[model samples]
Target: MTDVIIVGAGPVGLLLAGDLAQTGVDVTLLERRDGAISNLSRAFGVHARSLEQLDARGLADPLLPTGSAVGRLRLFQTVEVDLGALPSRFPYLLITPQYNVERLLLERARAAGVAIVHNAEVNGVDQDADGVTVHTTGGSHRAAYVVGTDGHRSAVRQALGLPFPGRSVLKSIMLADVKVAEEPAELLAVNGVGDAFAFMAPFGDGYYRIFAWDRDNPVPDDQPLELDELRQVVTRALGSDYGMHDPRWLSRFHSDERQAPEYRVGRVFLAGDAAHVHSPAGGQGMNTGLQDAANLSWKLAAVLRGAPDALLDTYQAERHPVGRSVLRSSGAIIRAAMIESAVGQALRGFAVRRALSVPKIRARITGQLSGIGYTYPAHRGEHALVGTRAADVALAGGERLYEALRDRRFVLIGDADLPGWEDRVRVAAPAEAGGPLILVRPDGYVGWAGRDGTGLPEALTRLAGAPSAHMAGHTAS
Candidate 1:
C-alpha cells in the first residue's frame, strides 16, 4: 500500500508524483508505455504562469536552456497575442517539446523516491470509504488516493463511471515536425486562406512543428500524408513553403473539446487530458494540464498529512471552471481560423482588432492566454489579495519568494511567531518594510494576507497541513 497511486507517467503525472514525493508522501506512478519518450512535440508552448510554477520548484532556470522563449505567440492566421507585459519572471512562452518537460519531471520524481512502474497499464480502479485500489496488468496496488493523468481515454475515469461530455470541434488537421530551410519572417508563422490554414513554430532546435489543414480534402486520420501535398497546402495558406523537408514525424489528427463532469469521484481524482481536452489553437492543452497537476498536488499532500478531507474538493471547484474556460477560448481560436468566406475573414480580423484595442479587454485576453490572469475563488469577506497570483518578490538575505517556495512550504511573508509549524511554513521578511503579511501557497498563490500575522497560524494549519513536529527530511534545507 502507498499513500497515493498515480496512473500515467506523462508530464502531468510526473509533476504530481514529484510534488507528492517531495512532500514525503509515498507515491507510485504507473505508465502504460515501456518508459521511452517519443520524439514528437505535440504541446510546445509553456505559458508564463506555468513557468512561475516551475520557477517555484527551482526547475525553471534549468529548463530555459532546453527551449527557446518567444514574446509573441501567433494563435492562428495572423491573430497574435503579445506576452511582453505579463507580470512574471518568465513573461514569454517557452517553446519546448512536451517530452523535455516530462524528462525533467520524471527525473525529479525518481530522485525524490517516487516508485515508478513502467508497462503497468491500469485496467480497473475501485474506491470505497477507506481507500482506493488500482488493478493493473502486473498486479493490484492500493493507496489512500488515486489520480488518473492518463490522457483522454482514461481507464480510471471510465472505471469511476464518469462522463466526458463534449463534441469534436475540428477534423482532418494535418500535424508534423520537420525542418524548414528558410526561417519565416515572424517567429511563429500562421495563415489561413479560404479553407487552407497552416501554422508553424520553431522547436528552438533544428526541427519545426507545423499544423496544416486542406479543408476541401477531408480524409481519414489514418490516410498517409505526402510531403508534396503538405507543401501545396502550406503554399496555399501562406504563399511560401519556406523550403520545408526532412520530416521526422507526420500524422493527421482531429481535435476534440472534452471535459469530464467531475474532476473528482470519491477518493479517485482525474487531471490533465484525462479530465479535459481542447483544440490545439492556443497551445493551451498541455499548459492547462500542468496547472491542474500543480493545483491538486499540494492539496493532496496536505490532505495526506492530516489536513481536512474537504481540501481535496477544491481541486474540482477550482480547476473544472478553468478547463471549461480553455475549451471556449481555444474553440474560438480554431473557429476563427477556419472562417471560410472572405466576409467572415474580414469580420474576424476586425472583431479581433477591435476587441484587442480596448485596454481592459486586451489585458484580460493576454492574461487568460498566458495563464497569468487566473485566480482562485476566495472565501466570503476574505482580503482582496487572497487567491491572487503572487509574483516573485524580494525577500530578506537576497532570496526571492519562489526561491523560498522551492521547499514546498507555505511562505509566511512577514514576521510570524509560529512555534509548531516550522516544517510546513517558512517565514520570510520582505526585503523592504511596511508590506502586507501575505501567506503564499506553495503553488505560488496568496492563501491569506493581512497587515500583520493575524489569522496566519490558522491559515498555515489549514492550508499547509497541521503543524508537524520535526524538521522533515523531505524538505530541502
Candidate 2:
C-alpha cells in the first residue's frame, strides 16, 4: 500500500504529490487524462500565496520562466489595483496558465520519485480504520490516505456520500484564447457592458485570453463556439471592431458556489474544487486549492512520520474556514460584476473608485487579492504567536523567516540560550538582529513566538516535536 494516493493531476494535486515525495513518502498520483493539455487556459492567475508555497518546495524558479509577473490587476471601469501593495515576499501575481503550472509540478513530482498513473480514473473508494482502498479503472490500489483533488464533479466525493451544498449562479460565461494583433496595453481591462462583461488579459505571447458573458443567453451545451459570436461579444463590450482571428480554443462554463460539508471523511480527504467550487470572480479558485494542498501535505507527512494524530485534524479546522471565506468573497465579486440594474452598476462603480482612493481600504482589497489575510487559530495553551503565519522578519543568519523555512522543518530562532528540544527542530542564532525564541513549523508557519520562550514547550508539542522528557510540561528558554 502506498502512503498516499492523490486523485487528479491538476496543479494542487501535483503540488501535494511533489511535497510528499520530496519528504520520502511513497505517493502515487492518478490522473484520468492521458497527458497534459497546453491549449486550455482554465485558470490564468497564480496569486502570491501560491508562489510562496511553490518557493518552499524549490519549484518556483524552474516554473517562473513559463509565466510573467503581473503587478496590476484591474476591475471593471476601475483603477488598476497594484498587487505589489500586498504584504508578501512575492508581491505580484504570476500570470501562468493552469496547465503549465500543473506540468511543472508534475515534473517536480517525477523527479522526487513519485509514481504517476495517468489515465487511471478512480471509480470508487473504501476507507476503514486501517487504510483506504481506491478502485481505479486500471486496477485497485491501497493507500494509508487518499486525497481527492478532482474537480467539482468529484467521483470520490460522490462515493463517500458527502453533501455538496450550494446553488449555481445561473450565469454563463465564455472564454477564448486567441492571438491578438493589438499592441500590449499597460493594464489588462475588465469592462462591464450593461448586462454583460468582458475581460482581456495579454499572455505576453502576442496572444490574449478573453472572457465574456451573456446575461440573457442560456448555458450552451457541447455546441461548437463560432468566431462570429466571440467577435460580436468583444465588439459589444469594448466598442471596437478590431481584427479578431486565429482562435486556439473556446469554451463555455457556468459558475457554481458549492462546497463539501467537510473536507475530511475519516482517512479520505477532499481538496481543491472537490472540496469547494465557486465563481472565479477574483481568480481565487486555484490559489485556494494550492493552499489546501500545502496545508494538508505537511500534516500528512508529520502524521505518517510518527507525529501526533491531532495534526491531521487541523487540516479541516484550518482550511474549511478558508474555503468558506473564498465562497462568500467570490459570491460578492460575482454580484458586483453581474448586477444588471443601472443603480446597482452605478453604486458598484462608485464603491470601486472610493475603495481605491483610501489606503486602508485599498490595502484590504489587495490583501484579499494576494491571499495574505489567511491565518489559522492558535491552539489551546499555545503562544499567542503560535498557529499564525510567520511574517517575513530579518534574522541573524542574513535570511528571512520564509527563506529559512525552505528547509521544511520546525526552526527555532533565538539568542545563544536555546530551549531544550529534539533534533527535529533546528536552531539558528544570529550575531545581529536579537529577537525572541521563535518556532516555525515545517509549512513555514510560526508555532511559537515569544520573548522568554513562554510557550515553547506547548508549541513544540503541538507541532509534533518531542520536548524534554526529563523536564515537566513548563515554559522553557
Candidate 3:
C-alpha cells in the first residue's frame, strides 16, 4: 500500500506528489490520459506569490529563464495594474504557457521518485478508518490518504457525492495558439470594447495565444473555429488581428464559478479545480490551485509522520477563505470586462483608472492580485506574525531565509540552540541582525515567535505535533 494516492497529474497533483515524495512519503500519482503532455496552454501568468512558493523549493530558477516578465497588466483599453511596484523579488508577471510550469513540476516529481501511472482512470473511491481504497480502471489501490486534483469534471468528487454548486458565468470563450506577424508592444496586452473582448500573450516562443470573446456571437462549443471569425473578433476588439495565421490549435469553452462545500471527506481530500473553479479573469485559476497544493502538502506530510489528525483540518480552514475571495475578485473582473453598453464600459474604465491612480488603492490591488496579501487565521492567542508568511529575509552568514527551507524541515531562527528539537528542528543563529526567536513552519509560515523561549515547547508540540519519544523529557533551551 502506498502512503498517499493522488488523482490527476496536473500542476497541483505534481507539486503535492513531489513535496511528499521528497520527504520519504510513498506517493502514487494517477492520470487518466496517456503519458504525452499537450503543448497548448490555457494559463500564462505566473504571479509573484506563486513564484515565491516555487522559489522555496529551488524550482523557480529554471522557470524564470523561460518566460518574459510583464510589469503591467492591462485590464481594459486604458486601465492597467502595475505589478513592477510590488514588494517582492518577482514583482512582474511571468508570461509562460501552462505546459512550462507543468513540465518543470513533472520533472521534479520524477526526480523525487514519485510513482506515476498513466492512462489510469479513477472510477470510484471508498474509505474506512484504516485507509482509502481507490477504484481505477486498471485495478484497486489502497492508501492511508487520498487527494483529488482532477479537473472541474472530477470523477473522485463525483464518487464522493459532493455537489459542485455554481453557475456558468460566460459561454463560447474562444482560444487559439498561432504565429503572428506583428507582436504587441507590451509583454501582456488586453483590450475590450462594446461587445467584444480580447487579450494576447507570447509563449516565449514565436507563437502567441489569442483569447477572444464576442458577446454577440453566441455559438455552441462544437462550432468549428474559423481563422477569419477569430480575426473578425480581434478586429472588433483591438482594431487589428496583428496578422494572425497558421493556427496551431483552437478551441471554444465556457467559464463557471463553482466551489465544493467541503474540501475533505474522511480520508479523501480535494484540491485544484476539483475543489473550486473560478473565472480566468484575473488569471488566478491555476495559481490558486497551486498554492492549495503547497499549503496542504506539508500538513499531510506531518500527519503521516506523527502529527495529530486535527492538524489536517487547518488545510480547509486556511484555504477556503482564499478560494472564496478569488471567486469574487475574478468574477468582478470578468463582469467588468464583459459589460456591453457603451455607458457601462466607459464607467468601468473610468472607475478603474481613477481607483488605481491612488497610491494606497493601487498597492492593495497589486498585493491582492500578486498573492502576497493573503494570510491565514492566527493560531489561538498567538503573536501577529503567527500564521503569517515569513518574509524571505537575509541572514548574517550569506544564507538567505528561503534557502534554509529547501530541506523541508522547520527551522528555529535565533541565537540560542535548543538541543531537544535538534532532531526535528534546525536551530540556527542570525548573523548580525538580532530579533526575536522565530519558529518557521515547513511551509514558510511563522508558527511561533517571542523574545525568549517562553511557550516555545508547547507551540512546537501544538503546531508540529509532539517530537520523538527520546526528546520528550529534555527541556527546551
Say which prediction, candidate 1 or candidate 3, comes out ahead on TM-score. Answer: 3
Superposed model 3: Cα runs more than 4 Å off: 472-477
| Residue pairs in clash, model 2 | none
Of 2 and 3, which scores higher on TM-score? Answer: 3
- Model 2 residue 91 distance off true place after TM-score fit, in angstroms: 1.7
Residue-level error in angstroms, candidate 1, position 212: 1.6
- Which residue pairs collide, candidate 1? none
- lDDT (0-100) at residue 299 of candidate 2? 85
Top TM-score hit: 3
Q: Candidate 1's error at 402, in angstroms?
A: 0.8
Q: Against the unseen true structure, what C-alpha lDDT does each candidate score?
A: 0.86, 0.78, 0.86
Stretches off by above 4 angstroms in model 2 are 415-423, 430-432, 465-477
Local distance difference test, candidate 3: 0.86
TM-score, cand. 2 vs. native: 0.92
Error of 3 at 442 (Å): 2.2
**What's the alpha carbon RMSD for model 3?**
1.6
Residues 1-477 of candidate 3 have per-residue lDDT tens digits of 999999999999999999999888999999998977777658889899888888888888889988988888887787878898887888988888888999999999999999999988999899999999999999999999999999999999999999999999888889998788898777676887858888888977799898889898979988989889999999888888989999989989888999999999899999999999988878888899898998899889888877789889988998989899999998988888888888898899999999999999888888778888788898577788888878887776788777787777788888655555565677766665568888898777888998778888777776666766544343334
Ordered list by lDDT, greatest first:
1, 3, 2
Q: What lDDT tens digits, residue by residue, belong to model 2 across residues 219-318?
A: 6645667778877877776665256679888878778999998999899999999999998777899999999998898788878876688888889999
